[model samples]
Target: MAEAASVTTTLYYYSIFTSPPDRSRTSSSSSVSVRRRNPSSLSWVLRCSTNTSFPWGCDTDSLENASALQKWLSKSGLPPQKMGIERVQVGERGLVALKNIRKGEKLLFVPPSLVISADSEWSCTEVGKVLKRNSVPDWPLLATYLISEASLMESSRWSSYISALPRQPYSLLYWTRSELDKYLVASQIRERAIERINDVAGTYNDLRLRIFSKYPHLFPLEVRLPAMDGNVALVPWADMLNHSCEVETFLDYDKSSQGVFYTTDKPYQPGEQVFISYGKKSNGELLLSYGFVPKEGTNPSDSVELSLSLNKSDKCYFEKSEALRKHGLSVSQQFPLQITGWPMELMAYAYLAVSPPDMRRNFEEMAAAASTRTTSTKDMRYPEVEEQALQFILDSCETSISKYTKFLQGIESLDLDVTSPKQINRISFLKQLAVDLCTSERRILFRTQYGKRPGPGSGRFTDGAEILRRSLRDMRNGELRALKILNGFRKLFK
Candidate 1:
């Protein structure tokens, strides 16, 4: 089996659209067995099954829609599958194993014609012409196309697929501004989500002013709204699968077959909800884009971004700012803190930010080198400089943690019974995500501050550094244990 790290990277490598295709193509002529459909429309029913070990709920309408879509895909040249759509506790609707499947089995073979890509030709030719001529980037263009097709409803070629889509996606884009402010005030994800929403609106406005407004007939007002949150592509039945940190399956276009295919990395049993990684996204990222968060401590790729800047009150602030500017870095810069630790660039920036006048001459060299190389907190020396830098990071992380803690406390005091269940769950996830991020970041800072060894200790002369290190270690372990306990308790409610 592929290691989880490499598998996560593979998922990303396949999902990105780097360039437009020259022409459309078709897949093999293989056929899959299709279940006979009832003439009567399936009722939109939400069934909660208590028999499953995990909480399982399904909408009959969605499953019916998925079944129709599968048949359409098969007729359109999709190869046979051993997987079928089912209700899943993790993602509402997901692809589940229909039978025992082996590793390296081909789960899906989506034809190029069915695969939505940047090069997809739009039904509205005039609008497509303008977009193509102007070279609108792939992501936004694809998003626009998806909305355009969706607006047509039953008339669309992808009507069944559209019907199968989640009516209420849990993405941050769906969160109200008030909700974002209340729950994600301290998270860096909130800023990114806001920026993305603004960008989508901006892109739509620009298109309207330049093209749609003039050719009103081609682009109707009903279809002019922005629908995309960020980079996304809709793959019919393939998208129904939820994300898993353990699975290595990934969707990618195969030039040889002229279709999109995903291979299973591990064996799966019948009735198991098979999953594909939506890349190794952080909990915040997963929530922002997909509307879900992995269990606490399970997401290995999780990280939190911290903003750092030199204090204006410092005597050498001007010098440091100038040095940072020379290296294409702003005085205020962001650094990512991962579970393992932080990058060398953070330490270099911290060192430069607090370096004295005598060390100022070396700033340019240090800044240049930092940008090109990878450094860790352990690798960073200069006790005086690093101490200040680590302290700044520690303080920032603590402040963020405090903000989340206050919000969580405020929510706990409120009458949550009055709120919608969905809203309650979203708030709960956001609070936990904030706590997890803060905990991971603090661990790194603690390690930086107290991980170093002290000289030998004598009787009645134990080194203060060793004592402090042991204390920090114990505290870190306790924090992790508390997080685990809290997570376990949360699961009980589910």
Candidate 2:
């Protein structure tokens, strides 16, 4: 029996049951098996009543995917890191976990071909349209490139993800019929493409960018994984990792070895359900990238406490205050969401978009509870509102802001609290408020953390301030100097 190492995952039954072609091109026929020490009913393999690990010849659907992946790895001519797949049961569904990981550790290595360049056309819907027609030399980079390009065309209002794109795109989606008509303006495209472009644009762009960006140097332009057909594939891992936020873990990339390392990011302690984020922000970007429809907000005519949590550390250092003030979008992970509507539903869509096919059906059942019931009250029963919300999230993934506002009007009308005129009026107010808050929060927090200069006695601070003062006083003489006070504060807090 192999001991579960600090960087190992559960021994998935599939690793043993299916035999893939040689990925390393060393041998045409060879097989491996994993043995479990403690067998339980919840384990992945059913026949292994006494063995906790998968048997050598067990066959299952997951094994099929693994077998294919194994071949891709072998033929890539990369060094083996002793990684394997494993299954665990929790609540109503099964999950995959990468066994061990260390903080600030690297797991997978990808090629630059797989990395979506920031300069790609995703920044402009107009550009995205042109790229789609262009032939991509590599298919693995297709989805990511498309998404990044689409995101540049729009922004997100929902999740922390989209706002974290290299650039802050537009955030709203789901345009009004009139609004959609406006974009088609002398541009010869049809209304349907416009709608879809809008959808993909608004979907969340965060997870895709951050998870990949954090280890950008690892992945190469072309992926080399073993395929079952005795060939190798260049499938980008970014094309994989689907989007479950809960009950999920990932393989880290090793750039030196040019291979993927595995680890679990989620655990049973979090919950049994699968949670995924559309690769972008939750508001409009999510819908655009993945076509996820979020639940609409209920007009309960009552106040619901919007919950925001800060750890003890945050409160002690006034980090919470700083966050609230400095809350504009950043390029790093941990971007915040402007949740005015159904967060639960948004979470569900994200989970589904990235979840393995086996787990997606389960997500649908769990999310059904959040869906508006037809028998519910005026505040709750708004299928139309839900649809509008869904459309907005999807549209923002790839479309523009002017278009998103138009679609938001459709969502506001579904609220039943307003007529056509009121819907139009509310649209401007909501979009402005969301955008304004995003900017204000970022600025305030940034300033609060670095706003004050030290008193006269504080030499370092005094000197810096004096330099700035002197420079300003001599406006025509030279450029003013600036210090990185915020960076200093961050290090202190950490």
Give lDDT tens digits, candidate 2, residues 1-494.
01111212122111100111111222223221111111111111111124322122222224444444445544554344223333323211122323443334443454433323322334334333433343222221333343332222224111121111111112122233454353322111223335443333322133225332333332211111101222222222222232332222333334444333344343322223222222222222222222222222211111111112223342222322232234331111121222222233332232222333344334334234223221212121222233333333333322333333444444434335445895656455444433332232223223222323222220111112422223224432422222356667778999
> In candidate 1, what are the lDDT values of residues 1-494, reduced to their tens digit?
10111111110011112111112122234221111111111101111123322211123336777777778888877777888876677666667899998988876777767777666777665566777687765555664565556545566777666556443333566566776776677677888778756655676677667766776555543222343332234466666666787864566556565556677899999999887766666666666655556666677767676677788887788877877777778888777655555555765777777777787777775565345332322344466564455556566656666665666557555436647896777566655655554455444434434443322221111122432335445656877999999999999989
Q: Each model's TM-score?
A: 0.72, 0.24
lDDT for model 1, please: 0.56
Error of 1 at 198 (Å): 2.1
Off by over 4 Å in 2: 1-66, 78-95, 98-105, 110-235, 246-280, 291-337, 340-494
lDDT of 2: 0.28
